[model samples]
Target: MIVSHPRRTIISRHEQFHLAQQALRRLDRGTGLIALGASLIVGAIAALIWLQPHLAPVPASIAINLMTIGIGAACLIAGWRRYSFHRQLRAATAITDAPMIDCWIENAFEGEPGVIAWELVTSQPDGTEVRLRQAQLIDPSLVTVFQRAATVPVRYVPANPTVSALIIE
Candidate 1:
């Protein structure tokens, strides 16, 4: 009789962080551009208000323009904050070094379509056991893949072992 073991897949924390940062930047870049466009539109509206006839109602025009400017400013601020967060995530990922471990699937279930919850357990270098339960949005069919995997890869920061992520790849 012959028994063959399944191949194991491991991902370094740096790679994971890089993937996360890229995803975040991709999502936020479009949002930031849209916000900037809105800001430009607001500026154009203010210019139009000033260019209108002198007999035009000034108070109402000023009030509307002020509101538009306020909204535009808010959008710009939000976009800047998102970009800042992306940079911070990138920096953190560059500095973090987490160990990869083999984790066995304890249980798995689907909360909704395209979402899976995985309960995993792994042992630390010191012989301590760590349990991580997380839910992620993925293809509904991936539940079977998780079940078939002999062992899943997990990475956690040494400083905060509780903060862990299930390696999807």
Candidate 2:
């Protein structure tokens, strides 16, 4: 079996540090969505109740409030799972200085427009298997990179492959 190297993306400690910072920012951004979503939902509900009792009912105004509510629900659902994933990302940071190994992109799913979930797998010399599944928020420009790559760089603790991270852009 032939295993590829991870020099293409992460080769130096300085570069890895920068990548780690970006990853944290991306992971942390989920909170913004959650806040926006909750605000919209609450505002919509309040408007619907308060305005209905004060002003004459207009079909257009009612529709606008409903739309806001719908959009808010979408945002909330999208960020709900993301908040938990952010914690997992923090835990995965332990692999920062660990060696990188090329792992097969066993599966890829674009659950949303700019978010991609990847399943990575590799074999160890001890006949053990390492499997990791991560869902990440990605930039539109790098969407093609993730979609086209057959293998990506992964860092895992030597003693425990379960604590691994797929260096994402």
Candidate 3:
């Protein structure tokens, strides 16, 4: 007797991978720009006050500078949080023969300690669609990344697709 096993699906990630990489780069770049801009604005004002002969305007007061620095520090903290969160998501303890698929977040909700519920979507080569349900314990530190990113690359074993991990970290 002859038997045929289902051919494993072949998914090309050339464009998908680049697109995801570009998206992530854009996110980090934006975060950096925000922090940098905030710092530059305050720095420019302070330099003008110090370099000029006349007294600067009230807007350049010490209180204003402190407030501006506070805002910039907050942005830096949030950016750090996002970077760490992505790192954790992509960190894997072991390797497997799981296939990576591009997926989008269908929806998300939060509860105590921020348990996030999201449905991951994928399109198969056979014109079939797959949506896998997933949930993770989300902490406040990681919420920044989740709130900013919606596309999550996922890897799963063909035998047991129910258990999966995020292709992030």
TM-score top scorer: 2
Model 2 gets an lDDT of 0.55
- Give candidate 3's TM-score: 0.34
Give the per-residue lDDT digits (tens) of candidate 3, residues 11-101.
2334333433433432342457456756756785675568444545565565666666667667666666656544544443433322222
Write down the lDDT of every candidate, Cα atoms only. Answer: 0.46, 0.55, 0.45
Candidate 1, residues 1-169, lDDT tens digits: the string is: 1111223344344433343343334345347555775866668586656655663766776676667676777777677766654454343321222222222221222233332333345568888977654333444466556544554454445434444444566
Ranking by TM-score: 2, 1, 3
- Angstrom error of the Cα, residue 58, model 1: value is 2.3
Name the candidate, 1 or 2, with the larger TM-score value: 2
Clashing pairs in 2: none
Q: For residues 75-165, what per-residue lDDT tens digits would candidate 2 score against the true structure?
A: 9887876675555545653333322222222112233224334345656778887765433345545655655565556655545554445
Of the two candidates 1 and 3, the one with more favorable lDDT, higher being better, is 1
